[model samples]
Target chain A: MNRQFLLNLRRGFLVTVCFFVLLGIAYPLAVTGIGQAFFSSQANGSLTKNGSTLIGQQWNGPKWFQGRPDADDPMATGGTNLGPRSKTLVKDVKEQIALLKKERITPTPDLVTTSGSGVDADIAPVDAYAQVNAVAKARGLSVAAVRHLVSTQIHPAQFGFLGSPYVDVLQLNEALRTLR
Target chain B: MGFTWTIVAMIVVLAIAWRFLGAYMVSVYEGRTRWLSYIERPIYKIAGIDPDAEQSWQRYGASLIIFSGVMLLVGYMLLRLQGHLPLNPQHLPDVGPALSWNTIVSFVTNTNWQSYSGETTMSYLSQMGTLALQNFLSAAVGIAVAVALIRGFARKNSKTIGNFWVDVIRTTLYILLPIAFIVAIIFIAQGAIQTLAGPAHIHDLLNGVRQTIPRGPVASQETIKQLGTNGGGFFNANGAMPFENPTGLTNFLSMALILCIPVSLTYVFGKMVGHIRQGAAVLAVMVIIFGSWLAIGAVAEHQANPAVAAAGLSHQPTGNMEGKEVRFGDTSSAFYNITSTQTSTGSVDSANDSYTPMGGFAAMTGMMLGEVSPGGVGSGLYTILLFAIITVFIGGLMVGRTPEYLGKKIQAREVKLAAFGVLVMPITVLILTAVAVSVHAGRAGPLNAGPHGFSEILYTFTSVTNNNGSAFAGLSSNTAFYNIIETVGLLLGRFAIMVPVLALAGGLAAKNVVPASLGTFRTDKPMFIGLLIGVIMVVGALTFFPAVSLGPIVEQLSHGKFF
Candidate 1:
């Protein structure tokens, strides 16, 4: 029994190390290397840079369209797990509505409700259009031009069947920068 | 709305996969599949294992333990040395020791209960190399154990069950790999990212601030994450992240992959035992429980938050959408949350913590019910079979006859082994949860106050104990205290129950078959299926009722609901 146990242990160790080399090291590296060769932009973080530093831009001012509310920590990401009935959520929504009213823009449901990921990169087309007048005013552009820009930024549902239509906030903001 | 249609679409897809995948699995296990012999031969030769040679349950169990132990060691080494590894473009540091232990045990046991954020903590090397690799092996191990148990029932007075090495190899090479590769391709096509590039620096042109967007080979990891029932996410946001699951189709596919093997293995069980209805009976029980939980969760999630109703703001027609993806909406997200927990695949496409109190209960209770509503990949099959054995034992006692399941007589030893397997999880979860709540470190973990806070701690232990990896996501569980305790919970949760399960297989394998007669209880019938369901429900409720009551139940009640 002892002899068999030792032999089994030896076999186990050897096989595990061997399998690890095949699976843990070689396989992942090969796939990733192949991926890099074929899909460089995605593999390298779909980045469109301005200047040098990585961007953590929050679009609070009227010059750019706002995305989903982000978590407090810039590096961190999560949803606001506020129950619909919670006073905190209601207060926040009411405050958002009041602010939108001040800007003479009606708040869309998407604008006030936090997304599953607080770092949502897109907003519904309606939400995007709601901010057009303010963005037009801030950028010294015509409302028709800003609306046209929003129309250009609108992305159809993924593959035409998966999600609703939306505009990518980053892409929209990039267009805003180009306008300037 | 799209919510109801998504659920209908899911059922149709699952039903198709069930018939095809189930039949295919039967062929794979029976060695009737001809496509993979060449690859299988080389593997057996290199491992020095005789594919045809059967192993006594003792040797089989020992092999499983030793294999897992060695893999755990290899994984730990890779994680600790990840900083120096080649694929780490982010140059992340080595993991802390306790978290390392926790992670290694988590994946090795098929728990995959990630306490750390994947993008921040794991490099591409650790994510692909260590975590994803274990996803396949650990799931293979689970199926191997389950297959051994089925073999125990099939063989008549046999000295051996089956070869563990052969089972594991065939499961990975033929079953998991081909499917994962194909699914990975589909995911990539659907915009799920697959790349090796470092985190990209993006300048937010609007705010003039710089943001670094983290990216990696996510599609490849995502496939196995769902397919292997290993729920460790490529990102901390898990399947909810657009990168991990890009669209509605991916969401549907992810849910299907999580459940495919587990559901099909029931058919494999029937084919092995020479009775297809036996598989149907188990399948029915799984569907009934799973369907009921999904229904309750959907209804609860679809209702307006009572507090939201009280707030008197105009609410959207769609039900509570607070923490759910806009693409999937309420019903689909609720269904996914319940399914993930029930199957022991912890990947959440929605924030389960933000679910209504009743919806959260439905999710928690699924885990608390031992996750055998088509449980984790292979673990579900064996665990549920154990319950069936007990059910037969009970039926026998009531009718004044000897208990027989699939023609194998249930003896005193079989009963004890099954009971031990069933009882260990609750004991471990309850005891650990009590200890956690009493300690200062544990108290500091929950982010919420009141019963919801209690649910966070409770959900953590329950998820770990059942080897179900989903969490409430409201707990700060990254500290050394949680890591150590959760590790202990995961290890015991896996091997404590696993060891006895193998022992039961051995016991069953040694028993002489008694042919079914009119006096013999028919386990493949609807009545038997009902009885089996009752046994499972009673055991789950009895074992977990108090703790659950203290957590989700009271939380829901406090919110003014009876159920």
Candidate 2:
């Protein structure tokens, strides 16, 4: 309202504009450019042959090795966030158990549980192993052969202890394509 | 054992970083180093700012407010115009009025709470121009205020703190930008997405479906989101998504980045106050509290999820894998989230709402402690100091001696300002929670039922008021009522305390150091550290015990205890 206030506003406006250009625009663009130059695959999205994603997708039927239960919308991905004592969590888990029962598969916790992001990329190695027999029987393949495929796809936690050992469903199922 | 190793590694890395970063900040604030003067000078000129000119605390506060206000306005404009903007590969529409108001206020205050799922909502231009931009500036603003407060202790009878413009500029250029750049590259190499392109569509025949996966300049924003303690994620899953945090090393690095400045500023405090021990005492207090909570949380999450157990699927060895990524496992997720919550870097690698009730309790309590266990970049340092002031006051009363800290006499004005600053967040959280629970709009927000439902609401208000930005991920909070009400909480939570803190800095700046007597309270000693921790806990417990009891505590009791 006064000259001092006016001066402050002017100064504030100019500085804000400066930062917007320098930090907001220039900095991110530079990072993007550098990322594209060096790590092009990662920067653009880690896609493999035939447009396979790094993450797992919804796999249904007894023949396909299913990933974890997932949300349909990847664009609006987030956790189910069911509390420890919620009726919703109880009901969902029960429904998942019944589905696994129909498929005649051993129920693994990861198989039943939804992820933080609806589109989780990997499942626990145990989760993968639980499906080996079910898929093997459904596909008329030897259980040993399907189990070996699952074994080959297991990615140990980085540095043996950094994260959890897991299998990428995309890689595992792709390996399954090679089996008799 | 690996989880234990993580604790040990964090200790060593943060200890090393604490000293170096602390010293670097000392140099940056003292104007002893002009590492990037080539660009800094031009920026100052462009903005009509005189770098050498000093500002009284009032002027400094006013400048900060005006600048933040301007940023909010511009950011809002960007969000509203996202559909019209250039980088809309997904072609997302513009944000609505109430959500935009909530969002800009959230970012401007350094809270980063998202009522909207980011990947579906924010365009590439909006991500870079608005969200990522604020991540740098708001964090820089935090560091500036913190350094200003450090100067309040460092200077003797000074009429001014430092130039707000110069401080903001130097922090962005010298501190945040370079680190963010280097780490952005590292994030990219570690598989974080960073491109101008839009979503990647994959036609995999697994389900005979076409998947449109979102991608953008994620690595660019992800680095600063952690480094600046701005935990706004590129994807809605935040740290959990493989594209955002693909490896264990990146997760460890993010944990380091989140704690980096908050931990170092204590050293800066010590160096500025001419007593290094003073900073160590504060750091020791932070470590004790942070470590305990991390252990409790890790142990709690290591147990099988009861929901998993109920489904007869608890045979799997990885404890509580529900709503958690396989890469991080349950224990590692607990570690990352505890670090995130403690530092006010609220990025999540797992669904916090699905944690064993105690695990959620641990995360919630960290924010409830005013996030002073080495909190968000700048806010952490000052809030802890507020605790120290109160500790000294209470300690002085117990001994019947006049209180002094860093040679400055503690009086009524300083005490009142400190008390007001300390109480602002909790009081606002309580009031907002009460209002939200009573109304249908608030009650309908939580996705879960019973006590957990109550927690979703409590956690939302607490996260907003504290400016910690992490949510329970269970609240349907995009409604107009929450948007408008939370904007009020965000503003009051941020500015209300900040004004008083600056006033205190001015008051402290005016005081002359009184020579220490035998009876003078020794704030740099072990006793002070113990009392400081005591003060923080007592304050937190007294304020939030009833509210928490209704949420996590009651949920825990209803389910029976793991311990």
The best candidate by TM-score is 2
In model 1, which regions exceed 4 Å deviation?
A: A33-57, A72-75, A80-101, A129-166, A171-180, B305-314, B559-563
- Estimate, for each residue in B91-200, the C-alpha lDDT of model 1 and write its tens digit: 89999899999999999999899798888899988888789889989999999999999988888888898888888888887888888877776676556777776666
How well is each residue in A1-180 modelled by candidate 2, as lDDT tens digits?
487678878888888788778888899889988989989988877787534355668776788888889874667778888877766676788899999888887888788888877777788888888888899999999999999888888888677667778888877777787789
True contacts kept of each: 0.34, 0.75
TM-score of chain A of 1: 0.83
Which model scores highest in DockQ?
2
Show the lowest summed lDDT stretch of 10 residues, model 2 chain B. Answer: B554-563
Tell me each candidate's TM-score: 0.92, 0.98
Model 1 lDDT vs. the true structure?
Answer: 0.79
* lDDT by candidate, in order shown: 0.79, 0.86
What TM-score does chain B of candidate 2 reach?
A: 0.98
B281-348: candidate 2 lDDT, tens digit per residue: 99999999999899889988888887667656657577887888877888889999999899887899
Cα error, residue A38 of model 1, in Å, equals 5.3
